[model samples]
Target: MLPESHASPDRKRRPFLLLVLVLVALLGVGGYVAFQLGGDDRAPVANEPAPETDQPSTEAYQPWFAGYTDLTATPVFTFETPDSESGRDVVLSFIVAATTDACTPTWGTYYTLDEAVEGLDLDRRLARAEQLGGQVIVSFGGLLNDELSTGCTDPARLVAAYDEVIDRYGVSTIDLDIEGGNLRDTVAGERRAAAMATLQENRTAAGTDLAVWLTLPVSPAGMTEDGATAVSQMLEAGVDLAGVNLMTMDYGASRADGDSMAEASIAALQSSHRQLGMLYRLAGIELTAATLWTKIGATPMIGQNDVAGEIFSLADAAQFNAFAQENRIGRMSVWSLNRDQTCGSDYVDLTRVSNSCSGVDQGDQRFSDVLAQGFDSRPTSAAPIKTTEEAGQIGDLTDDPATSPYPIWTEGSTYLADTQVVWHRNVYQAKWWTLGDLPDAPVLNEWETPWTLIGPVD
Candidate 1:
C-alpha cells in the first residue's frame, strides 16, 4: 500500500533531491548495477563471460530472471509520488535512462553538465515501486548516448547485453530511442534488428513477452528517410516491433517555421501509421491503418524544447492526450520526468537544459497530471479498503477459462458490475465494469479495479 517504508507520510518535497529517487529511475531492481565507465565514443569490447562472471549470462539466466520478475510491475512509478504541482495522479513514469552508454549501459541519464542533478539510489526507489505495484519501462539509446547498435557492434554480444538487461530488469517493455548518427547508421540498424529478433524469440519461448518500442525523432511532416529505414530494418529482421514512439517536440529543422506543436505531433503520428503499414506489406505482413494505429506511441518534451522557438506547452499536451485516447495508441510518454518543474525566479534561461526541473511553469507534477488525466486504465499499486457489509458477500467463483461462462481476464477487456473470471490459477470477480487493466498483477491495488482476485483454486 503506497510502497511502505520508502518515504514517510510527510516526506521531503524536492522531487529529484532524494538520492534514491535519482539513483534508479529506470535502472535494475536488486541493487546498484555497477558499470564500466568509458568515454561515450567507446564501442563495447566483447568481454567473455570469463571476466565479468557476475554480469548476467546464459549459464545464470534462470535465477537472475526470477529475481527480475519478483520485482516487476511494482517499480513503474519511477519518481516519488507526484509533487503538488502534479495536476493529476501519475499512472506510469517514463523514467528515462537516456543516451544510455552502449558499452556498459550506465542505465541513467548520462552525466551532462547541463543537468542540475544526476539521479541516485534508483535501485532503492525502483524496489519500493515494485512493492507498490507501479510499473517502469527502461528506454535505451537516447539522443545523447551511443546506441547499442553503434556501441556494441558485435551481434552476438549485442544480443547478450540486451538479453542481460531484459532479464535483469524483468521489463516487459523496452524502448529503443534511436536518433542522430545511430538512427542513420544502416549497418548498426541491421545488427540491432537481428539482435532484437533473437531476444524476442527467446523471451517468447520462455513463456514471457517482450514489447520493443522504437522511439525516434520526428517532425510535423513525418519520419525522415533514415527514420523510416530504421523501422524497416526491424520489420525486415522479423523483430515483432511493438510500436513506434515519435518524439513530437523539438521539430528542429523539420518544423514548418510556425506550425502548432499539437498539429505537428498529430501529423507525425498519422504519417507514421501510414508509413508503418506500408513497411508491413513490404515484409508480407498485411496490417490495415486501423491495426497500425495500435502500434504507435507519442512522447513530447513536456515544456520548452531545445529549439528556441519550438515549445510544447501544457495546452499542446492536453490536445495530444485526447488524441492518444481517441486513437487508442499503444503508449504515451513525456520526454524526461526529471524536468517536470517550473523555472525558479532567478533562473531565467528556459532554453538551457536543467535536470532538476522543467524550464516551464508546470509546477513539478502538473505536466504529468494534466497529460495523464482520464488515463484511468493504468494498473494501480494502492491497497484496497474493505468494509464489513460487503466483505460478508464474498464467495469463490468458477474455475473455467476464457471460453467458459465469463471471458478470460485479458488486458483491455471491459466488464460490467459483478463480472467474474479466472486469471492464472486464481479466481477473479469484477466488482464493477472495468477494461484494459491487468488483474492487479501484484495485487497492490486490491481495493480498486473491477476484477477482484479470489485466490488460487482449491
Candidate 2:
C-alpha cells in the first residue's frame, strides 16, 4: 500500500523520493539511445571523463540497517542488538554466486566473506535466526560476480536452479541483483523470464506465493534501454514480477550542493515507474501509479562506494529512511553485511574491496540501525519538500549576514526570495522562495536551486 502520507487525495506519490534514489535527468533523445546501448550500470557517462582510479578512497562512515549479512567465517559477526534480528523488518543479502554446475545452484561465499576461512556456515546461522522469528530474504547474483542465469543457460535447468534456491531456503521473496555482463545478456534475461513465468504458474497452482524482484542499475533519468527491455521481457513472458529493486550506490555521480541522495533516488524511481507503466501497458496490463510504486525497492551500498567521489553518508541514510517511510517503498537493503565497519589506521587500501569492513567508519551495526527506522510503518506526515532554495528572491536580499536579518537555514522551513541565513559557519542568500533544501548539501539538479553562498560572516 502507498504510505499514508501519500494516501490523501491532495498528496503526490513519492516513488522517486525513496527508492534507488539515483536520479539523473536525461538530456535528449541521443542520451536515451546511449543509455539503452549500454545496459550495464558501470558504463562511464558520455563526455564525463572517468575519475582517476588510483585516487585514495575515503574511509569513514558518517552509518543504516540493523540488518546486515555476516558473509564470512573469520569476522564471526552476529545480530546481537534488539533492533536487528528480533525488532525491525530485515532483508538478508545474497544467496548464491556464479557456479560451474549449470543445473544445480550451491550455497556458500563466492566472494569475500571477510578474511575469514571457509568455516562460515550461513545456512546454519540463518536457520537459527529464523527459528527466533527473524525474516530473511535471499538475493541471487551480485555486481562483482557471475549469477546462475549467466552460467546456467538452459531454460529448464535455470527454472530448476531457481526453485531449488527458493525451496531450500523456504523463502517467499527472492532478489536478482543482475549487473555487469548478465544484466546485458538478452538471451539469459529472456530465458530467466520464461523460467520464472513457468515457476510462477506452478507455484500459483500449488497455492504458494513467489514474489520475484529484479535488482538492476538505475539513474535519475531512468532505466537504460537494456533495463527497460529486461522488464519488458519479463512482463511479456507472463511473469508476475513483484518489484524492481534498484542498486542505488556507485552511480559515479556527485550531485551539486542543495541536491541529495534522497532527491536523486526519487528521480530515478519516478522515471522507472513511468517506464514500467508503459511496458505493462504494452503487455496488456495497466497498473495505477501507486500500485506501480509499491513494486520499487532501494538497495544502497553503505558508506564509501566503489566509485570514489560518491558516498552515501549517515545523514543520507536518515533522509532516505524518512523518505521511504513517507512513501512506503517495497523494501530496503544494504550491500553485504561483511563490509560494515571502521578500518584501522594501518589499513590503507581505501578503494580495494574488503568483505569484512565497509571501508567507512561504522559501529558494529550502525548502518542497520539507521536503515531500520521505519521498516514496518509508513509515515503520516507531509511530502518531502523537494527543493531547499531557489535563485530568485522577492525582497531586499543582502550579501552580508549581519545586516540581512533572517533565521538559520533549517530543513523544511520556507524562505522567501532575497532572504539570508547562516549555515555551517557560512552565510547564504535565497535566489528565490525555497523550502526543504539544506544550505550545506549538494544539489542534484545544477540548473536551479534556492541557495547561493555569500561569504563568511565577519
Candidate 3:
C-alpha cells in the first residue's frame, strides 16, 4: 500500500501515558471513541461517536472479502501461510508498467505475468486457492510504479495491456489502486477510464464481463478532489463501476490528534457516502443509502500506517468490522496479507512500518481474522456488469396503478424520506424529501436520483 520511500526507522512514539488516558475515556464513553496521537503536532482530530443501533442477532451480514498481498515483497507470500484463513480471497497487487515497455505489464517491477507463473509458481498457487473455494482479484497501480495509463501514451496499447493481464489471470474483478501522481494526472485518468470502458465493452460483446473497482486514497474529510474527478471520468465514459474502494489509512495531517484510526475511517466512509451520492445524482442516477453502501468498500492499513504515530491495532479492526457489518458495506480488505503477523524478536523497533511484518504485538492473532470476521462472500459475487442497453430497459416499461401495491409516483407530489411509490412496475423509496425527481428516470448511475428501487411489484 506504501512505497519504499515512505518507510523509515525513525518515527515519534505514542506516549504510554496518553494511551492510558484514551483507554480510560473509551471505558467511560461506552461507544466508539477517538484518541489523540502522542507527540503529533497536528491539532487533535475529533469525530462524532458512531450512532447507536440495535445489533443484528445473527452473523448473517456477508460482505465480499479479500486481503491484499504484495506480490514482490521479500519472503514471498505463497497463499498458504498458516495464519491465513481457509476460503479467504486474496487481492494480488500490483500489475504495473514493465521498465522496458510502458505498455507491458509486470507484477510490480519484479516478474512478468508469464515469468511469475513459472518463477513464482503463481498459477499453481492460484489454482490451489481456488480449489479450496477462494478467488482472486488482480489489483493494478500502486504507490510506487507507473500504472498502465500513466506511462502508456497510446490508447490502443493501454487497453490491450489491461486485457492481457485479465486474460492471463482469468479474473473477472480488477482493482485500480490509483494514487500519487496517477491520481492527479487528468489525462491519465481519462485515458484509463476510456481504456476500461473499451475493455469492458469488448469483453461483454464476447459473452463475458469485467467488474472494475477504483481504489483511491481518502482522508477523514472524504475523497480528495482528484479522486472524485477520477470517478466522475469513469462514469462519464459509461463504465459500470463495481464500487469505490477507499484506502482508509495514512491520513497524515488530515487526521485530528485524538481521533483513533477506526474513528477516522468510519468518518471517511460516511463522508464519502454523501459525496458519492451527489456525484451519482450529477450523473443522473439515484441510489438508496443501502445500495450506496454496497457500492463502497474500505481497506485499512493493518497494524501500522505509513504516517508516524498512526497504528491500527486489533481493537481498531474489531471496531471497524462492527461498523462495516452494521452498515452492510459491500467489501472489506486490508492493506496487505504480508504484514498480518507480529514482528519477530530480532526486529527491535515496532514503530517502524515494515513490508514483511506488522509493527505490533499480536499474541496469537492475524489481522485478516479480525477484519474479515463476517465477510464470508467471494469478491467475484459483486454486482454483475450491466451494459447501457441492458440498463435502458427500465425506462421502456410502464407502471400500471391498478396492479401496483403502492401509490403511483406523481411528479408534482412531495415525498418524504421512506415514502414508497410505484414506477415502471417497480417499488421505489425516497431517501429524503423531494419533488419532481422521476423515480424511473433513465439514469446510468444509481445515485443520480432521490429514489431507491426496492423491487419489481409482484
- Give candidate 3 misplaced runs (Cα > 4 Å): 3-62, 80-82, 383-458
Worst 10 residues of 3 by lDDT: 29-38
- TM-score, one value per model: 0.60, 0.62, 0.73
Local accuracy of candidate 1 as per-residue lDDT tens digits, 1-458? 00111110000000111222222332221000000111223221111000111221222111100001101122232353434323222222222223544445443333221231234345565566566645656656644436677767767778877776666656777777666666657788888899889988887788777777787766554555566677777877888776677767666555565778787777667556655654565456754333455566676765666556667788888887777666556555664454566868877877764544456777434666666654443311111111011111223333466445445677656777777666644556667777765553311112323455444433
Per-residue lDDT tens digits for candidate 2, residues 221-276, read: 56655666677778778878876776665544433356666666555655566566
Which model scores highest in lDDT?
3
Rate residue 398 of model 1 by lDDT. Answer: 36
**Which candidate number maximizes TM-score?**
3
Candidate 2: residue 400 lDDT (0-100): 52
Q: What is candidate 3's lDDT per residue for 116-191, written digit by digit as tens?
A: 9887788888888777777888988887788999999899999999999999889999999887777768788889
TM-score of 3: 0.73
- lDDT score, residue 242, model 1? 67
Candidate 2 wrong stretches, greater than 4 Å: 1-99, 108-119, 253-258, 345-353, 362-365, 377-458
Candidate with more favorable, higher TM-score: 1 or 3: 3
